[model samples]
Target: MSDSNTTDFTNPSTFILLGIPGLEAAHAWLSIPYSIVYAMAILGNFTILFIVKMEPSLHEPMYYFLCMLAATDLVLSTCILPKMLAIFWFRSREINFDACLIQMYFTHCFSAMETGILVAMALDRYVAICHPLRYSTILTNPVVAKIGLVVVLRGIILFFPYPFMARWRPYCSTNIIAHTYCEHMAVVKLACSDTRLSNYYGLFVILFVASVDLAFIAVTYTQILRTIFRLPTKDARLKTFGTCGSHLCVISCSYIPSLFSFLAHRFGQNVPLYFHILIATVYLLLPPMLNPIIYGVRTKQIWETLLRLFPPKGG
Candidate 1:
C-alpha cells in the first residue's frame, strides 16, 4: 500500500485474486450455485448454436444474430467462470499477470460485442416490424455478414486499448485483487501511478457505447411501435409486438444488471463492497444464463424446433 516514491515500483510476478472479499468462509457453498449457473449457461448457449446451425429454416438474419449472441455469451462467461470456479472450489487464486490481461481483454471485448449485437437485433426487429415488406431485401445475407463484421471490429478496436493501458501502469502496491477475475478497472486500480487517464477513458467508452446503442434501440422501437399501432386488426398488432418480446427481454437481462454494476462500482459510495462484487458477478452470469431461455420460450419457431428435436417419450 506504500506510495510509488517509497516502494520499489515493479509489477508482481503473479496477482492473487481474493474471490468475493470477506466471503472466504462461504466460498465452497457459493461455488455450488456458481457452478450450476455456469453449467446451464454453457448448455443453453450451445444448444442455441447447434439448433440454429442445423436448421435450414433458421438461416435468416435474426437467427444469425442470435448465433452471434450465443457465441459472445459463451466467450464472455468462459473467460471468467473457470478461473472463478478454481478460486472458489480449489483455492487456486494466483494468476499470471499476462494471462490476467488476456482474460480482461476477452471479457470486455465480448461484452462490447454483445452490446453491439443487441443493437443489430434491435435493427432487425425494427425492419421486421416497421418495414415488413422490405425486411428480406434490407437484411440480405451479405448485409448480415457485414453487420456481424462491424460488430466484431467495433469491439476489438474500442476495447483493444484496455489491456495495454493496464499493463503500462506501475503496480507497486499489493498484488491482491479483491475480485474473482481480472476486471479491467479492478486491475488498473492496483497501479501506483495516477490513473485519471485510464479512468476517464474507461468512462468515455462506457458512456459512448451505452448512449449510442441505447439511442439506436430507442429510435428503432419507437418506429416499431408506431408501425404496430397502425395495423388494422388487434391480432396483427399483438402478433407483431410478440415478435419483439424476446429481444426486449434479452436486452433487459443484459443491460439492467450491467448498468447497475457499473454505477455501483463508480458512484455507490455507501454500497457495501461485497454487494458490489456480487452484483458484478451476477451481471456477467445472468444474461448468458437467461438469453437462451428467453428466446427459446418466447420464440415460437425456436420452441417448436426444440420440441421437434426432442420429442416426448410417450409420443
Candidate 2:
C-alpha cells in the first residue's frame, strides 16, 4: 500500500502474486492439504506455548525464550500458511494492496525477531554450559524480556520504512508479486523508482544483522567447545554438547532456508519461480514445525515432563 499521505510518489493501485501454480490451476485439490498443514502449524505451536506456560519446571529463562520463539512462529506460520493454504484449497487467494503490506510487515517482523531470539538462546546455552556460575545472573527474566523488547523494536524500525518506501514510488501499472505474499524484495521490485538504494540498504541490513548475531553465536560456541574440551570426563563433554544441540539444530534449520532464499532471490537469476516458492515457504514454515520438536525431543527435562504428564494410556 502506498502512503496515502505522501505526495511525491503515487502508490500502485494493485499488486499481483505468482501463487502455487499448476495448483492455482487446481486450487480445489490443493487447498485441502494446504489448510490442513496450516491448521497443524498453528495447533502445534500453540500446544508448545500452553505446555511451557503451565509447567513450572519449564518456566526457566531457556523455556521462556523457547515459548517466545514458539509464539513468533505461531505468528509467522499463521500469517503465511493460512493464506497460502486457502489459495490452494479454494482458488480464491485475493489480498488487497494495504492488506498485503500489513502482512509483509508482520511477516518480516516476526521472522527478524526470531533471529534475535535464537541468538539469545545461543548465549543462554553458552552460559548454562560454560559459565554455570553466571547462568542465573546473566539470563534473568528481566534481561530476557529486555532482549525481546529490543527484537521487536528493531524489527519495527527495519520493516516500517520499506512499506513507506514502496508507497513513495509512483505506480505505472498494477503490480504482481510472483510466489505468494507481499515479499519484501518482490514488492520493492515493483516500485516505479530507482530501488538501488533500498536494495543496497536491505542487503547491508541483512548482512549486518545476521553477521552480528551469527558472529556472537560463533564466539559463544567456540568458547563452549574450549570449555568442554578442558573437561576431563566423557560424560561432561556429552552433557555440554547435549545442552547446545537443540539450539544448534534450531539455528541451522532457521538460517539454511533463509540464507538460500536470500541468495536465490537476490543473486540467482533464471531460478524457476517454483523454486523460489518452495524455498521461501520452507524458510517460513520449517522453523515453526521443527521448533517444538527440537526442544521436546532434545531436552530430557521437557520430554520427561511431558511423558509424566500423560503416561501410556494403558499399562
Candidate 3:
C-alpha cells in the first residue's frame, strides 16, 4: 500500500466515540432518558453523602465507609456520563488523546477504589456481627481514616500505569472507539503496537483488586452468617441479616453486570457488538443509579431520617 493510504502510527491525535451504533437517528431522544438517569445518580449519591456527614448519629464506621462509597460513585458517574451525554445531545464524539487518557485514569482508579470501599464495608459488618465487642476497637475513627487513605492510594498507584501504557502505543489504526467512554481495553485495542503487556497489566489489576475483594467479602459474609446462625433467638438472626441486605443489594448490582460485561467482552464472540457495548454502559451506569436507592430503602436509619427531613405534604 502507498504511504498516502496508510495511517500515521506515531502521531495520530484524536479518537471518535461512536455512541450506540445503529441508533444515530434516536441519539437526541435517547439523551433525555440518559440525562434523567444521570441526574438521579448525582442527586442520590450527593444526598447520601450529605446525610452521612450532617447526621451526628451516622458518624460510625459503617456510615463512614458508606460515605466513601457514595463519593466514589459520584466521581465514577461524573467521569463517564458528561462525555456520553455530550455525544447523545450534541453529536460531539471527538476526544483528544490526552483527554481520553485522563478519563481512562479516573475511570479505572475510582472503580478500584469503590471495590476497596466495599471490602472495607464488609469488614466493618464482620466485626460488628462476628466480634461485636471488638467492633468499636477494631474500626475506630483513625482506623477508618487509614482505610480510606489506603484505598485511594492503591487505586492511584495501581491504575497509574494505564494511561502510560496507552500513551506508549502507536495508534495507526482507526481511532473510533466502539463504546460511549474510554475504557482501558477499548483504547488499547486501537493501537498499532503489540499490547500484550498492557493487556496483561489490565487483567492482573482487575483480578488482584476486584477479584480479591469479592473473595474476601464472600469469606467475611460466610463468617457473619455462621455467627448469625448460632444466635439463640430467631429475631436476632433476622435483625443481624437485615443489616446486610443493603450491602448485598449494592454488591450484586455493582459486580454482576460488570463481571458479565467483562466476560462477554473477552470471550463471547457470538454476542452482538451492540449488546456488549450496551451491557458495558449499563455496568457503569446502573451501580451509581441503584446503590443509593438500595441503601435508602433497605437501611431503616437513613430512610427514617430522610422522611423526617422532608415530610410528606399531607402529613
Best by lDDT: 1
Model 2 residue 234 lDDT score: 97
RMSD for each of the candidates: 2.3, 4.0, 2.0
Cα-based lDDT for every prediction: 0.91, 0.79, 0.89
Query: Over the stretch 1-315, how does candidate 2's per-residue lDDT look in tens digits?
Result: 774323243564455565754345655665565566667767767777777777888888898888889889988888887677656655444677787888888898788889988988887888898889988898888998998889779878877777776667666544657667777777787666699977887787788888988898899899999999999999989977888899999999999999999899879899877778778888988888888888888888878877777687883
lDDT of 3: 0.89
Q: Where in model 2 is the C-alpha error above 4 Å? A: 1-13, 21-23, 26-36
What TM-score quantifies how close candidate 1 is to the native fold? 0.96
Model 2 deviation from the true structure expressed as Cα RMSD, one decimal place: 4.0
TM-score of 3: 0.95
Off by over 4 Å in 1: 1-9
For model 3, the stretches where C-alpha displacement exceeds 4 angstroms are: 1-6
Tens-place lDDT digits, model 1, residues 1-315? 754333555777788889998789999999999999989999999999999987899999999999999999999999999999999988999999999999999988898999999999999999888787999999999999999999999999999999999988888767889898999889998998999989999899989999999999999999999999999999999988999999999999989999999888879999988889899889888899999999999998888888899898998
lDDT, candidate 1, at 155: 93
Which tens-of-lDDT digit does each residue in 57-169 have in candidate 3? 98899998998998899999999899999998888999998999999999999999988999999999999999999988889999999999999999999999999999988
Better of 1 and 3 by lDDT: 1
How far off is residue 11 in model 3, in Å?
2.7
Candidate 1 all-Cα RMSD: 2.3
Error of 2 at 89 (Å): 1.9
